[model samples]
Target: MWLNAILGPVSSPVIWVPASDTRKAWSSNARSSAATHREVFCSQGIFGGFMLGVKSISGMAFSFYDWEQLELIRRIEIQPRHVFWSESGNLVCLASDEAYYVLKYNPDVVARARETNASVTEDGIEDAFEVVGEVNETVKTGLWIGDCFIYTNSLNRISYYVGGEIVTISHLDHTMYILGYVAKENR
Candidate 1:
């Protein structure tokens, strides 16, 4: 199922929804409140491999849809600060404020979604897939190579996580980004 973004500056509302088989993008009114002040924030979302996601800065909202088909994968009120994917896009690492979660993507979820006519969610997604692992660490930066997720935490320590455990850890002199991995020399 596909619906357009509920986007607007809190005025003259317009809903972006699918027109027959074609989807359109338009602005919609933002739902407001005293605490929130306004609604529907947008940002430069994340894109990697075949996935793209619109995640707000305040961690209030997010939506990930298919770039080509415009299929809605999910929509929720909270989003991770960082999301990293394996080269195959089958494994994912979701870095939140307190912890990072590793999840396995079910290839059949999309097919099952077309059947349910609903976007998948945790409670009723029924895809038989879920978070595979979690570590109580806030990752500064990380990258995925095969089954292991290598990341640096606030302690400036580089740790390799695989199979639900931290397999290795080493202290770093300074902060740096993980550009890529070379298997032959093993860094």
Candidate 2:
């Protein structure tokens, strides 16, 4: 039976269990003082392949897990106010209070995870992701507009990342917050 798990109340660690069998659940300690969000992704060709993301006071972190052994393989850090995986899941787009970043998934980490059985703490996996690009701007929220451009909601304007720089695409007089966005095509 497939299972569904609910995460948290913001200031605690995450607990997850099979809906039908609560006794067989798995839990991991919180990475920071306050926990904000979590996400799961696949690690391409690794044995366990599953990776988990937890956002907290320290930063956004991704932890690799070995399903069969139920061990944490490693943890990688990405400092962003918000983060989203691309449509293809090969890239991650991030929005910080003062900048935007794009990161490509690292296959080397998977290879290392497969070769080593030794576990790593959250602070150990420092070099897991490669930065593809960045744009200096205040990003309240952001999305990957195709594979090249990024659209972000700033304080009172909509900005975009193009040609390695941030360019304002639209402006507004009133303050606004962008929660989410959708990218239609590769451009």
Candidate 3:
């Protein structure tokens, strides 16, 4: 059956349906925690299309769905205190209580995942991700600035990542926190 081919033996419950496309549905598994917030983001790329659905709290996981085919491409386990996407949707920045991560979107992997019903394994996820940088103190929040990310750390300092190196920006007496930042005429 077409449904079986798309979703496999395990059926997914419909989470939301776009107003225009009733035939195409969005679905997810039962969330592990009620306290955690769930969010879905969709974006188009050169290979095809994809979406990121984040289940925050308890057992946190980032589930990537093939947007064009409407299939769960893969799932990656993450424990993030906070998560945010780049304005271009090309990067996902997340921070755990003790660390920070910037995950670049992989169109090649998305294409590979589209070829099979089986989800990508954890090893595959690791292979796709590159640890661009790390921090000793907890990362409070982060925002994308061009090809780099500016992260606010627990020490009231801002750390910047560009070209695989981290630059720390500190303040003497003032408590520095990122309320908001703008890039290239209101993006």
Candidate 4:
């Protein structure tokens, strides 16, 4: 699913491109949410496909792009939900009120996630974000007094392994998400 949003003048329609050999995907509601240029997050499926999270006019819309007979999966009931890609390439969506849910398109990963918790530790933990034991950099896992959260803004490093990289996924948010340190920086 190759959905691209081209920011033209101001009323440009959002286009959805199908990822198929035939390239036979139509654009529905092209002018949907033309008022605001909302950022769309793409998540890779475990079954060799992808899902699109777009801020439609109605609300936050999730739909399958490449799969057939695909309809809108879920419509987030938040005015402005925070959605991002998970470590497994699944969609990690969260509402402003802290309603966290993962829209998993990967059957294999979803099956595993459902059968067992992805946490490496065996202490009855579900959905644990693990930091591999091989980093030698300072990782800020707490907020200081009057501290800002964004990685670039707060000058902090968030290390999460995904897609063959230790990408900085979570920033700081004293109110919403909690930051935790897995291990100390190697000396």
Candidate 5:
């Protein structure tokens, strides 16, 4: 299935363009949060052919965009203080004030939605995530290594987490942020 894309000026409405064939593309008069152009949040979906976190009146809005139903923005009900996604876009870590969750986006849902040529229901997109792995700690910032999550916390501790379990732990002299990871050097 060809993954469609949402385009057009942020101030106006959104245009859903089929990346493969612009001729079949259609536009929507409905407003999207993208119109606000808020920074410090929002990431394009890397693995799932969707968009990640976006800010909404409800704090943070999570939605999925696909080719079949290009107009509807079915939202998942969850607000996180911060969001960290993987390079390939398959994995995401959502952080709140007290805990963080690691979610693996399931591509099968997108495939099924395309096959049926139906709009993916809200529950469909929500079920697209593997059971979220939660850890009871406040994360300041984080990065992703494959399915693993590496982060620095409010306690000034650097921890490597696999499925939300601490695999290795270390302390930082001062609070430091994890910019990114180099897969080649494994730094």
Candidate 6:
């Protein structure tokens, strides 16, 4: 489901909702007094992954779930923080200024649990990130960098192609970015 909100002084306020019935409750924010405020807190839980806290204000707070439970594992009093899943299902939280935290899960355990499991196939070689080039394709997608390759959709032009190479380029148009190369496998 998709949601959009516009806040401002208008003649008539309009609320739009999807047709589907699936819905979840979210926290709300309010002001208590001139010097105090009430904030609605939220978090995201990706099954078999991590839990990340979602706050309303910028540069206010960030959190990660405990390794065992998808609950608030650690909370940091910071500002302008963002959290999301990396390429490998790892929880990544970006905190104050330029600070970042990356977490990963055990692949062996995950693979064995699936009913139809197969050998884990790595996209490319171990050092696949070292190759430099340009983005040959521009997917309206996201990327992440972990113990391996990380793709970022918001990372603007010069970005990494998950399971591919890293390129230093002139410009990242729909075609010019060389994601990865077809070289001999050295595993």
- Model 3 TM-score relative to the real fold: 0.58
lDDT of each: 0.61, 0.49, 0.52, 0.33, 0.58, 0.33
Deviation in Å, model 4, residue 5 alpha carbon: 14
Per-residue accuracy of model 1 over 12-81 as CA lDDT, tens digit each? 3332222232222223322211111222334434433335455655557665555445455655554678
Report how far residue 86 has shifted in candidate 1, in Å: 0.4
Model 5 Cα lDDT, one tens digit per residue, 1-187: 3332443433332332223332221123322433223322233221123343343444455554443434333355556677776767677777778888777777777566657756566444445677468888899988878777888999899988886569647887898998987879989
Candidate 1, residue 26: Cα displacement in angstroms equals 15
> What tens digits encode model 4's per-residue C-alpha lDDT throughout 74-157?
343333233343334443322233222333334454346536645323222222222222222333232211111221212444
lDDT, candidate 1, at 161: 91
Query: What TM-score fits each model?
Result: 0.66, 0.52, 0.58, 0.30, 0.64, 0.35
Which pairs clash inside model 3?
Answer: none
TM-score-superior candidate, 1 or 4: 1
Q: Considering every candidate listed, which one attains the maximal TM-score? A: 1
In candidate 2, stretches whose alpha carbon ends up further than 4 angstroms from where it belongs are: 1-51, 56-79, 116-127, 176-187
lDDT of 3 by residue, 1-187 (tens): 2443333233533322222232232334433211112323332111112243544334556554544444454456656656655666667666777777777776666565546623456524333444555555577767776677777777777777777688887643655667667555663
TM-score for candidate 4: 0.30
Best by lDDT: 1
Q: What is candidate 2's lDDT per residue for 68-186, written digit by digit as tens?
A: 33445445554555665565555766666777677777657755754783333445433456677876766665565455454546567877664456677778887765555543532
| Cα displacement (Å) at residue 148, model 2 | 3.7
Total residue pair clashes for candidate 5: 2
Better of 2 and 4 by TM-score: 2
Ranking by TM-score: 1, 5, 3, 2, 6, 4
TM-score of candidate 6 to 2 decimals: 0.35
- How far is 57's C-alpha from truth in model 3 (Å)? 6.1
